[model samples]
Target: MIFDFNKTTDISGWRVVDDGVMGGRSQGSFALNANGNGVFSGTVSLENNGGFSSVRYQTDQMALGSYSKFVLKLKGDGKSYQFRVRSSFRERFSYIGKFETTGKKQTIEIPFATMYPAFRGRTLDLDNYNGETLVEIAFLIGNKKAENFKLEIVSIAVE
Candidate 1:
C-alpha cells in the first residue's frame, strides 16, 4: 500500500498546485472527507491561459523494482485525469498515465511501463517509467478548458 485514506490518515503533506504558478487562474484544494476518503476538488480556469489543477504528495524514495503497476481506487465526476509519478523529486519531468473516471466507484490500474515522460503539458522523448524508485505522486486535471472537478480517492497501491 502506498497511501490509504482513512479517518486517521494524515494528509498535511498533500498540496494543491494550480496553473497559478504560471500565471493561470486555476484553483485546487485537497482534504479528507467525512467518509474517510481523500477529496481533490477545484476549479480549472482558463483565464490567463491557465486550465489545470493538481494535487501532489511527496514521499520518501521507495524502491519499486518488483512493482509493475499502480492501482487507484477512486470515484470521479465523470472526467479524465492524469496520474503522475516522479522517480526522484529532483527530476524536472514526471512519468504520466491518463485515465478516465466514471461517476461510480472503480479501480484503475496504470502500468509503469506505459507511463511516458512529460514536462508541463508536453511529452518528452525519454523512455517510459523504469519502476525503479518513486518519490512523488500526483493527480492532475487539464482538459484545456474551464471546468470544475472532484475526485475522491480511497487508496493507492502498487502491484
Candidate 2:
C-alpha cells in the first residue's frame, strides 16, 4: 500500500526490464540510479519511431492478492503517460491508462478492477493480478508526435 522510491528495503523482490524490442519501431530501456531508486527512464522519439519508450519492474513473488491494488511514486516532465499492468506473460492481455504529469512526487493508485480492454473498450476485472504473479511493469510515453519525454519511476508496490 505504501511505496516509496527513496527507499528499497521494504520491497521483497524487484527486477528491471529494458529490452530494446518494439512493435516495428524502436525500443525503450530501463535503468537504475546510483541513488538506489529503481529508475525507469527513457525517451520516445520520432525517428524510426514505433510507439513508446518505457522502463518497467516486476516483483518476483506476488503476495498482495486481497489487497488487489497498487500504489506507485512517480515524477515526470508534465506529459501524458501510461500506467500498465499485466497478469501473466503468456497472455498478452493488459490495460493502458492515459494520465498527465504530476511534476512532483505524488502517489498514484491503480486498482485491479479498473483496467479496461483496449480493443473492446470495456471494463475488465484485473482479478488475475490478485495473487497472480507480477509479470511486467512498464513506464511508457507514446511516440504519437516528435516529442521527447522522460518518466522516472521511484517505487512500485501493492497495497
Best of the candidates, lDDT: 1
**Highest TM-score model number:** 1
For model 2, the run of ten residues with the poorest summed lDDT: 15-24
RMSD to truth, every model = 0.6, 4.6
In model 1, what is the error at residue 42, expressed in angstroms? 0.9
The count of residue-pair clashes in candidate 2 stands at 1
Per-residue alpha-carbon lDDT of model 1 for 80-151, expressed as tens digits? 999999998788899999999999999999999999999988999999999999999999999988999999
TM-score per candidate, chains pooled: 0.99, 0.68
Give lDDT tens digits, candidate 2, residues 121-152.
24555443343455666656763764556566
Deviation (Å) of 118 in candidate 2: 3.9
Q: Which stretches of candidate 2 lie over 4 Å from their true place?
A: 1-27, 58-63, 119-133
Query: Which runs in model 1 stand beyond 4 Å of their true positions?
Result: none
Per-residue error (Å), model 1, residue 112: 0.4
